[model samples]
Target: MSSRKAEPREYHGAAGGFGSLQGIARIELKERAGPGAAETLYRQNKPEGHMCTSCAWAKPPNPHLAEFCENGAKATLWDLTSERCTPEWISRHTVTELRERSGYELEMRGRLTEPMRYDAGTDRYVRASWDEAFAAIGAELHRLDPKSVTFYASGKAALEPSYLYAVFARAYGHNNLPDSSNMCHETTSVGLKKVVGSPVGTCTLQDLDHCDAIFYLGQNPGTNSPRLLRPLMQAAKRGCKIITFNPLREKGLLEFIDPQDPVAMLTQKPTKMSHMYMQVKPGGDIAALMGVIKRVLEIDDEAKEKGLARTLDDAFLAEHTHGFDALRHTVENTGWDAIEANSGIARADLERAGDVYAGAKNVIGIYGMGLTQHVHGSQAIGMLVNLLLLNGNIGRQGAGCTPIRGHSNVQGQRTVGITEKTKLAPVEKYRELLDLETPEEDGHTTVEFLEALLDGSNKGFIGLGGNLAQAVPDHERVHRAWGEMELTVHIATKLNKTHLMPGKSSWILPCLVRAEEDMQASGRQTVTMEDSFSHIYGSIGKRKPASEQLKSETAIVAGLAKATLAHRETRNPKLAWDEWTGDYARIRDLIAHTFPDEFHDMNGRMNQPGGFYRGNGAHDRIWKTDSGKAEFTDPTVLNACGIGEADGRFHLVTVRSNDQFNTTVYGHSDRLRGLEGTRMMVMINPDDMERHGLADGDLVTLIGDAEDDMERTVRGLKVTPYRLPDGCLAGYFPELNPLVPLWYHDKLSKTPASKGIPVRIVKE
Candidate 1:
């Protein structure tokens, strides 16, 4: 095979102008959604249309006429493409043939049009009736112990199906309800619960408007969540001091041009985004945060000694917080020498950041996978909170921690009870209201889910949406796990690798996309979704279904539930599976009843164009903690990748390309990085590249070794020289995801340690 060549071009600013429009058009045209693209985009942002599945960034209280960004447009268009996949066409391509195609190639093939079952005899997917698929799944589920069944969901699914997914698992006597959150922002949930007594970000999306200082730690907003750039640009224009710490100085973080602004587009001049940029090495977030906290404490002491207003909030601390003195002691005891050496940031820089942080009356600290996809991800997240609480940042206007979540409605999934660790409150409430007796024992997480599949413990799997096999690490081992499952079912839209690699008895239950209308017995129905900030709103798809046979995920789940729960429904007569499928508003009422305090008036409130807030206690400074006060936590010196310089190993962090969203590959190009026509590229510092005797465009192999000394290799990744911190290398994921061992994750969250992996590079 010939190596694909790509040319590098520099991006001067963040999203806006012709580039954003052109990028959207490129994929729309590729998917053949060009004719009605404008109308589709209109409904995508309109009140009557579905929510943007691109980013979970909260929508405005009153959204503008134009609400979505370029990425949202791309996401909507991709899902509502004109192309369709038929059983005849699917049968034409064998599993082996499909396996050879790239993930991008598979998605581009078009939407799955009909229910299909794997026929191993012919090595092809043949059409199956909905009844046939459900019966098979129900039979398999009944054969296995409820404890052996795993009910998984994707971040893309709206609230209705996610609710049914959780309810179905519990009613069937299992707690193995794992979703995308386990692989993404679970650390934020775990860490925040310990510190602020809340699992979600304290600040709402509108709160960013009040912040005078914004600290971005190890996140690239441009590529991951482009919609976030709009507020960052507005904040910069208002003269807010924005400081960034990451291995790469992303173009989006450096400058931005609001395509919404006419003058900026005409002038080619961009808004200066980051006033200060610190290129801290990977695995340094914990140390860097401690360094900032130590500096802040030192300033507070000096101010107190001078009889001036102190850096720490005295009244807030005395009344609403605990363990401050111990946290301060830890920060002060962590030597400056260790902080600087570990963080790859100078002490003077930390002091400067502290000055900026103190100068601004309101501040917000934001982070992404770079903080949570590590061995000590939970500890790292708590350290950020410790830094924020020193000045009482939480509950302050325009000031708090924002764990920028990826994927739409991922937070909502957790809010409605799709978790491995089932809480007693929600479980008890469901049993009381729904008249159901569900399991109490907690189930497996994402890593543990696959591990169970590999062992004999787990025998069945049902996915709501997403390419699970591709998203998890240790691809080969995951394949082995799939092969072990007695039955597998996928509620998906696009044809991906996971569908091709099926269990002994597998079914591809093609479902409706968010961009298409989901009509049922009660007529056209609308589902509810909550954003990252907990703004709950209604999403009604306007576009007609791509195929007549396509069913909503809600309907699919309902049919499954109706069939599966037939035997157990005598005692639980209130289980209204049919009503939920008929009118999604009924699901909202059930949800309101299940979570009364947070979800009151669910049916009426969601109808409002702007939606409603679920209300976080942190937003009100009412910490629902064990002590009824916000608590301080001691910082831990976590080794992100567990690599030593003497070993000649590089810290590898898996990343998404500019054109990709989660596992969906729009194209091979990453516009922000100026790389096009390929995704098989690895970036390393010039010094490290030279040390390995490699040059730009040179092909190299990446090797990851386990503690058992078992070697796993990904061959022929082209090297690209970057201005990264020494000992750090970056590559696009789904490709590098295999290098991350299943065991290498945050002890609490179990999120894939995709942000940091230890590997050695060898010339191919």
Candidate 2:
């Protein structure tokens, strides 16, 4: 054999700092082909090129642009790889065999070329044709009650594809559409909608630049949303005060050097990030936020007593709000002792933070999953908005609420109506537009959708995109339910474990990668994506499709509709499937007619480089609540159940490593924290380690009860002691996703309890 050895795993240096963390040994967590494997994976996936043509955010000229952040680059490379999951390949490897592989390795294998069906005897998948697959799906739908089918749409889908998916499901006579948003930012939507009329954020990117102060709660933009760093740096350069509150000391929140800045990168200089950092315990956001608001109220009262112009915007509040007396009573009656104890922050610190907000001329509050993945996440977000309204921060230039979103187009997916609960006007307008009957009943949420599948109430599933099996909590239960489906359809660019959970008749339809041009009868087509700032932009692919067999998401949806719903005239009379092929204009026309104020002349606007911004409540200081004002919620004592032991167990908070994003595992490298090639490590405080007789690099096992009876154990994890809270330990998600029970979700939003899972760790 040749003497050329495999290359060692590569470390990309600290994510933000000029140098890596000191004292910590450079630990290669696994024996993967280091950073070279990343490049190899990229070349394999992108036989055509490394750039993503589908994302407007992708940098120009350089196909593998540095504009691609670590996670984005990983996603792009994984999609364009040269691997293939052909029928023959599946026949050789059983479901059990595939299950044994890590999620990262399995997905890295290649694209799913042909439609497939599950074979019980062989315990493997076999090839099937598009006609046969669609016929089987249609037959199943025809046999079952409409409610028996649950349609799921992932953020990976384009607007046209998602709209068609929703239309098809509604026309088929069911409203069981449970989507990815139900598990992520459902709380943001529910809380914001109740307070602001619109479920989306009230601030744009421009607001960040002009804001005097920014309060960041429960969000880590560095890992989940790296692209947001540019704007954040710009805001910091303009002398904005950024205050961050979280359970762990996130490196990204401290300082960052823009990778795009040649001078800064070359000189190894970094921009200062958070002006004030407060370590709030898990599930402590509500109390912490409440404490800040109480301080603000006291300060305003003091200002009034001193005859200084009242700190409170009295004129604005009197003109725009209601429920002030009730709100005032609740805030004043609450004790400072309880706030300090529950929030784990000192009274002085809370006052200082509040003073910062009160002194600022304009302020914006930004948050993410940290606030939404808890039992009282919705209530926590509500408190943030209430604080903003106290100072008349709404309907202003630099002041509003911004919720940083995960997934490139997660916000856009919701914009196109991939919701479990359909609004009446949108449904009625769609019906009038298409001349079809719209389903009125609200569909299932993610939790309910899975339950329906487990109980055999739902027989068919159609996933527009996403790794549902891995993304959902309680993997054992979700995987079992997924295996029992009658028919399953996945439109995707690559293979994941979700695709392997074969239904009786499963179809893994290959779709064009985001970087590839979507060609149609009309000509080359462009798609629209809504960024976190609510700005819509046009994205046209610059690369060719990996193969002629691969189709655009739009084409696939249109094709599926033509194949299944073509026979039904009443449900789809105005729907000439051909007209929608590669023509996003028609879709825009429909969207414009439905949401006239926001999407007016959407096609005409697409020609402009930077698309228009969606109107937000920040412009008019108008709160959309029933009282027409933001209301304060009393801090309530919250309790979590099903944690087995009261002592010796800590809340195992699942977080995204610096290199990864959401459920998509780009690689096993956390450059900012100096972890490489492995994710089976947990961060613990050194003091806690000494008390537990644990040491650095000690092999341990994490055991936890997902439900009352169901338990999960992850073994052979390396312990890495750090500066986490006394009763808290940190681990990466998807790997630890099994420990989170599906039933243990936020009561209001139905989001997985990934942030506060109680578990016991012991020496293996």
Error of 2 at 15 (Å): 3.7
Native-referenced Cα lDDT, model 1: 0.82
Off by over 4 Å in 1: 1-10, 568-571, 642-644
Q: In model 1, how large is the Cα lDDT of residue 98?
A: 87
Q: How far in Å is the alpha carbon of 508 misplaced in model 1? A: 0.5
Clashes of each: 0, 14
Model 2, 1-764: lDDT tens digits are: 12332221223343443332211112212222234434432432122322332222312222333444544545555555556767788778887788788877776666767767677788787777767766766666666677877878776676667677777777777778777778778888787777666677888666776899999988776666655666677788889888888887766777787666679878877787888898887777777787888889998999888888666888878887666666677778878887776677888988999999888999999988888887777777877887887888877889988887765566677777677776622687776788877777888888898888778887888888788888888777778888787878888766778877888767777788766667887788877667666766566665556666777888777777766665555455587667887577787787778678888988887545335676766456666777766655544552222243367878788888765656666567676665666899888877778778887778998888444788777788888866666777888888888888778777677887778787889897
* lDDT (0 to 1) per candidate: 0.82, 0.71
| Runs with alpha carbons beyond 4 Å of true place in candidate 2 | 1-68, 567-571, 638-645, 705-707
lDDT of 1 by residue, 1-764 (tens): 22332233356545566688788878877887856667767766457777898888876656666688878888888987878778988899888788898888888878889899989898889999988888888777777788988888888788888888888888888989888888888888887887888898888887889999998987888888877888998999898999898888788898878777788888978788998899887778888888888888888889899998888998889998999988877887888888888888998998899888877888998999888888888888888888888788999789998889887889898898888886723878787888877776889888899888777788888998988899998887778668668888999998998887888898999988787878887788888788878788788887878888889988898888877877653656777888888888888888898888989999888867667888999888999888999988776563454544546788887888889889998987788877777778888876776666777788999988545455678988888877778888899888888788888888777888887788888888
lDDT of 1 at 609: 64
Give the least accurate 10-residue stretch of model 2, judged by summed lDDT: 21-30
The count of backbone overlaps in candidate 2 is: 14
